[model samples]
Target: MAQDKIVFVYITFPNSEEAQKVGRILLEKRLCGCVNLFTNINSMYWWEGKIEVSQEAVLIVKTRESLYPEVEKEVLKNHSYSCPCIAKIEVSEVTPCFYRWLLQETGVEI
Candidate 1:
């Protein structure tokens, strides 16, 4: 059993196709164990001093803190949205089974 904390990352994309790009790359590269894409999400934010709204898909990426910098760089470089949103939050705890599976999927060691 592993006692590792997971890092939760959030990223938004304009559409499903774009979101899939990130998902595929992350999974293929073993950067993330999973990415939950939420479609039909309405996002509203202020950009360049103006309010903007769009239909976006939210990506919930499951990874580790050590991978954040690279994960961010890859997404920012490939994402179509300007000034894309990327945020991270630390996981305080997780089930040992899930933690081990995450480690296995990402090829990370505890």
Candidate 2:
């Protein structure tokens, strides 16, 4: 419980291809510990004063809160949307072993 430094970043992409690209970039750059992509989800949102709906892929990125800004920049740089959906959820609870693994993967020593 109380995983203060960990965060789950939620991002929606137009397709699995883009999601994979961005996910790999994040992993390679050590910006995130891991990324899980969920594909073929229907998303509806408002944009430019109109409603839009599409099949989208969502990426749940696990990382430290300290790296959030860089992660956002990386996603924005590779994203195709004029306005992409990027949200971060604080990780309130995590198993100690898994949390340590996350930190180690992201190049943080604990």
Best by TM-score: 2
Clash counts for the predictions, in order = 0, 0
**Can you tell me which runs of candidate 1 are displaced by over 4 Å?**
1-4, 47-50
lDDT of 2 by residue, 2-78 (tens): 44488999999999999999999999999988899999999988868999888999999999898899999999999
TM-scores of the candidates in the order shown: 0.87, 0.90
RMSD of each: 2.6, 2.6
Residue pairs with backbone overlap in model 1: none
What does candidate 1's lDDT look like per residue over 1-110, in tens digits? 44446899989899988999988998998989899999999989887999999899989999877788889988998899778889998998878788788888988665
Model 1 poorest 10 in a row by lDDT: 1-10
